[model samples]
Target: MRVAISRCLLGDNCRYNGKTKPNAAVIRSAKNVEVVPVCPESAGKLPIPRPAAEQRDGGVYMSDGTDVTRQFQAGACKEFDRVKKSGAPLAILKAKSPSCGSDLIYDGTYSGTLTAGDGVFTRLLKQEGITVATETMVEEMHPSVEHPVAIVLGTGLGSITDLVHVVRRIDYHDIEGFPDNAQPIEGHRFEAAIGALDGVPVIVYPGRIHLYRGYSAAEVTSLVRHAFRLGCRDIIFAGATGAIPGKVEKGLGILTDQINLTGRNPLAEWEGLRDVESPFVDMNDLYSPYMSSIARGVAKDQNITIGAGVFAGVLGPSFETRAEVSALRQLGVSYVGMSTVNEVIMAHALGMHVLGLTLAANYSGGCDVDHQSVLATAKRYEDDFQRWVRGIVHLL
Candidate 1:
């Protein structure tokens, strides 16, 4: 485990006034994992001995408010880029430091208080999928144990068609928007999902926001932010997809090993706005082989059929026609959908172990595709889906 660490924590006399924090765990982890020390302030070209900084109004800057936010952002960016090139699997940053707070950095009030803020480097590193852990969290998660995994179900599932044996039912009509227009806990959507899995111990984000909802880049980036805050080092996505025609496998559970997303990547720009280097999160080895083995094991136990392949992400609300399916097939898409890709990308970029499973409800309209039938098929498989998911959760 090649890990990126904060220079200040490593006893480097790199603080604005030439002081060091000297974290003990960093030194301990160094004995085991190869530790790469980095100071975003130094990386961004700020001299080793520099002035103290804080966040103000809308940006981070020097204490006297000379507006050195640009310099801090640039340094963070360069350090992040260097970390990526080193292929480090994890990062340990100082909490509450203007340069490396995972979250809750000081709000520049200079009053010794914390806020729902991200250090310039913290935000940038998360965008690239490097696992960010503060000193406190590292101690809490030091011990590894197996706990029940929780799988939360979102929208686009089989409706309550057959309520025969159902003893309990949550009315969807009374709950904002039931079948359609239902945005589950916007802003806190990830937290709500994590709450469901709280006692289970293992956390999973089954489905997330589609990029086409006209959401700003930051809003989308928050998905991973919240996940890390919840202490999750791994995330598995189980998405619903429309199968492309003549793709060999259609309307079956397709476990995607890769994603081909053509639109904008979340990390393509910063313009000295935030700390961190390049936004490119690594795609190589995005899927967890250990998790894959667990899923395959569950499949054998449940007698469920699952296909492993690539899932292509496309903007949607509109179903694809036969021609569109043909085009997608040529693009190497075995399954197509609107969600999951961005979430998976963000997770992998954050150095979280990512696994994606697509529940293909129907084949895109090459000849026989009906909305009613698709809903019915999804409904029919709900029980089976739940059982398989529970098994996977236990494995996680």
Candidate 2:
């Protein structure tokens, strides 16, 4: 694959500050393909360590109020021509700059606020019908569809493994960058399986660690990050929770929304995630409407009742007390659990379409229950759970 890239991203000191914005992700891709590095500002005769520039009033201007619109435009044309002559079909541009920004740039006010817009050179390339993406998005690009759907099975809901034609199995200890203490549950395997479920490629994590297990929030949902690296654009999270009694019953439900009562967020680890453009990813309609609708229809067709409700995530190895349940009921939580929320946060941060499903293992408010009973109930509905996953897989 021949691709165009911003020179600064390729480690050239071409920025106004004379510093390169080196991204290991772009460099990795460059190793496997031809990378045509272009620095539009330098091409326009702007010297390294020159005045900083930004887009304002639809024109390029220096920080000292000097208008460089003509020079920027001229360089944009030249860079476009170079990319055209190279015959590159794809490009990875720096995300927030005056000359090469692809997704967002500083607001004209120069207050460090960001707005959606393209850089001068990016606009020229778009006019030529070239596909342009940010450097952060480069890691997910692949020549073939290897990872399509990601499923994280919670507690004892991992029976989906039996139906999948196994392709690859990677253990947690073997996964790169996971915390040292990140181990799977005693009975459930600590591994990820890449396989085809009813002919649809999917990656399944049979068991997930929890916040109560002395793991950091990022450590709890590290599998989500791995899934993005595997090129999965759509992810499904299936977990077990306790029902809120009247609002929802003990069976299955689709998570319409979630309240992060765990007091810990996976995105708080953003300072360590230099590969992403930003960690404050939007959570609007966080659960994919299209996937949820398909799941709803599948449940009905398979004679399985699927309810929709808000889920409240708590930090717990201990079950919720009667008082805690009442407080959650006041907040309109139909189900409550300990896992799934952190993974959901990480999944959305990576721009993947998310689908969340929960099995109501018991009445959370005041039910006399034990973990053994919960696991037994989950195993009991294994057949129905598999049917629902298969029906949804067919749609994907």
lDDT per residue for candidate 2 within 1-396, as digits (tens), equals 467889888899988899998988778667745678898888888767877788999898888898999888888889999999987766778888877787698776777888999899988887786767777555443212565688899988988877878978988777655776665664356778887887778888888888897888988878888888898988999999999877888988899889999999988874456776665678886886546755775776689987789999999989998889889889999999999888898888778878899888899966557788788988888888889988876654
The lDDT values for all models are 0.61, 0.81
Error (Å) of candidate 1 at residue 251 is 4.0
Clash pairs, model 1 backbone: 44-75, 76-276, 77-276, 77-277, 128-349, 129-349, 129-350, 129-351, 130-350
Q: What is the model-wide C-alpha lDDT for candidate 1? A: 0.61
**Tens digit of per-residue lDDT, candidate 1, span 1-396:** 466888878788877787887877566655655678889887766664555678878787666656778888898888888888987656788888787987688888777788887888878777886667777655433322332132323344422112113222333222221223436432113223222321235443433455567654444445454555546665556656777667746544645455555475655432222555665556776666445645665666678877766787776657787777777778777887766666666666666665566667777765555556555666667776666655655434
Score candidate 2 by lDDT.
Answer: 0.81
Cα deviation of 91 in candidate 1 (Å)? 27
User: Candidate 2: where are CA atoms >4 Å away?
Assistant: 1-144, 275-278
Predicted structure with the largest lDDT when compared to the true one: 2
Any runs in candidate 1 off by more than 4 Å, and if so which? 1-154, 157-199, 203-207, 269-273, 367-373
Listed per model in order, the count of residue pairs whose N, CA or C atoms clash below 3 Å is 9, 0
Cα error of candidate 1 at position 7, Å: 39
